[model samples]
Target: MLARLLATAAVGGVVGFIVFHPREAEATGPTATVDADEAQRWLLGGNAWFVKGGRHVGDTSVERRTAVAPSQAPSCTILTCADSRVPPEHLFHAGLGDMFTVRVAGNVAEPVTTGSIEYAVEHLGTQLVVVMGHERCGAVKAALSDASLGPNLDALLALIRPGIGEIEDLDEAVRANVHAQVAGLRRSAILHHAEAEGTLTLLAAYYDLDTGVVTFLDSPPTSAVAEAAASPRTPAEGHAPTH
Candidate 1:
């Protein structure tokens, strides 16, 4: 599968060139080695507060904006759906320059998206990369059926098809796509080196529209999957099924 994944990238052309490039990126400041565990803790805590109707913890003030103007030292990079309801900053209570985010229809990890991720992990010193799949995603729904939307959207849906082969359930298919994206990203030689040296981490996540909670959907251990199941959510926090 790994070989096949790289072969797909090579045949596609862009990712093959970008993945094996010899250039390395240097962090602008210290603390660039912020580990994935620490970043995940901060994100989860912020999300819990968001669900509980607490105040936003992220600073979006002028001072904060000016500080990060020259360079950004975000702890993580998030790639999620371009769906309006799944806004990363609002969902996570993140401020300006807090995290680098890549938003597209299906959160697909193709050559261009993967290349952007490579920049963040290699040059920006980001420690964590999250590929988030949410409930009731329209892109997944369209891909599950044989609907011809248009040329651009059709191309986008085609990228998501293989990840969700033979799956009929929308929620299950969404999770499957997330795992498939993570696998494709992990095969990058640059990312492979970072993981091999214990510097970078790639993981999948799920967001519940009702609960406003983000669940880490990685290969779980120590009963985290059960412990982090859906919790009671507020009526106001629940979205109106826009996703």
Candidate 2:
């Protein structure tokens, strides 16, 4: 049964699962002790470098490549839209083995995506999880339309609809969508347990296409005030494609 399931996952070519029981509660890595603050700072610094066209591409040297070929230890997990323009690595100026990314249309959290995230949190030593929404998201925009969609697409639209509320503004709805994904992620037992243990931090962010700015949204207890709070915005790299 396990072999069959793994085979099916491989055929789908969407999410590939590795069945392994993690040892202990601590993240495993050379830099396993990286806390939530350091993860956030690293992302911010990467974005700064990216915006300035000084992207420090990861250690692509043959020796360095061979070193990490044995294993990966990403510091963060980013759940972002599948928009071709919003590649998480480019936005954060990351290189190979630096980040574990989960991408889906509208960046909505569904079972498959959630499962991938759980795998990262449980096995990849990732301390930070960012659910990012971008400007002019097509998925959110479609929710505002009455156009008929196929069952699969309709299901995706349904997940994004509630986030939009009654707001007609696209940008506002996009931010709301990020908050919604963050909430959905919290429903995962693995994620919730990690956060409760102070080993994880969940964040929401918005990526503006025009300015390449990524503004971190305030988290819970302050989430209600996120829209109003003046957040520190960093210039992100890359252009976002409509997903």
Candidate 3:
């Protein structure tokens, strides 16, 4: 009798488990949609709250909902290095659609890169373009260290080499690379026209990985224009041009 009772109990438990574990088709629910503007507002508020040492006003559900929304057009375009350490969203405290970002090794502005920037400016209506670089950049380091590379890499290294050659210090070389890329972007016909017409503003910045701080090379706005203007034409040679 006891054996029969134990068998009956086991049967019941097995039946209960089977009933509770529904098939995949039966477990689905209605899809949830997100509102982009509300998400942006929440993200902006969250950043401000975090900066002020305040608690999260919203919960994970809200963030999850926000994640599903379509990203709106970005007002700013950033051309930055493809470094794992330098995540643009985290560094800028931005959420989806807040900034349009293009990442390349060494943040080199080749023709293709400039073309993308032009499309963003002309179509997406991004008013600001930032060319950013970071400390201990591996691309810049490779260009500095390696004298010989295969054709494709050598071409990339050539672009980075001019900037590396401009600065004696490795640390300064990183910043010089950022400034050089910014100059290269500015000189592009599309960007130059945009700048002259005051439709776009181009700036360069350096990211400090250790400190989590971004220093604008051309702070005060005016200084960037002046510095770019004063920068020697033959920057790689390290000689300031005489009047």
Candidate 4:
């Protein structure tokens, strides 16, 4: 897919030539060695731009496509919910090949997902992992309500149930579930070693559907305190769910 896009860029004329020659290199900058703090700050800036209706630079340009054709070294890996409204690339105003994203219904990290994250960190040199949960997520709502579901869905929700106890509000449950997923991710030895060695940082975040805002929950509370700590908060804390 990346190769095809690059081919089109190669033949696309003056604009293509400019995009191919110098612009691509300058825009994509080698992400292989980006530090966790720099990567997270970049994502936060992009999210702020998205909330302000700013256009993403060089995202779908032919030059960008061509530059990343040979290889991809995304700076961060995002584990977010499968909500259509919260596409990670779009929410963060990131370009193609800039973010390695893994999407599941509730943003839960099972063995498969954890393995993928490990690969991104160990192989691709991705520095940051953002586990993003969103407001009014259908999967979360179903799990919180204990809605009768098919066997497959029931099993998936069971993974989420351990995180949410008696949290009645949908938003609060969503937050707790994020922490729970973080806890699950911490169990990965690969991730543990990376964090210990200062090569990786795992973060929790929340997305608001209506406001197009993403809030990074810095130093998220541990799972032991996740349920107990969730409480109503003002907009600054990213607790007010517009949806």
Q: For this target, which candidate reaches the highest TM-score against the unseen true structure? A: 1
lDDT of 4: 0.68
lDDT of each: 0.69, 0.67, 0.56, 0.68
If the candidates were sorted by their TM-score against the true structure, best first, what order would they fall in? 1, 4, 2, 3
Q: Which portions of model 2 show Cα errors greater than 4 Å?
A: 1-31, 219-243
Q: After superposition, how far is residue 163 of candidate 1 from its true place, in Å?
A: 0.8
Q: Which stretches of candidate 1 lie over 4 Å from their true place?
A: 1-31, 221-243
Clashing pairs in 1: none
Question: How far in Å is the alpha carbon of 164 misplaced in model 2?
Answer: 1.7
Q: How accurate is candidate 3 locally (lDDT)?
A: 0.56
48 in model 3: Cα distance from truth in Å?
A: 9.4
Return the TM-score for each candidate structure.
Answer: 0.78, 0.77, 0.63, 0.77
**How would you encode candidate 2's per-residue C-alpha lDDT over 122-241 as one tens digit per residue?**
766577899999999999999887677999899999998887789888888999999989999999999999999988899999987876657788744343223222222222321110
- Please name the candidate that would achieve the greatest lDDT relative to the true structure: 1
Models, CA RMSD each: 12.0, 10.0, 21.0, 11.1
Question: Could you tell me which residue pairs clash in candidate 2?
Answer: none
Higher-scoring candidate on lDDT, 2 or 4 = 4
Candidate 2 local Cα displacement, residue 241, angstroms: 29
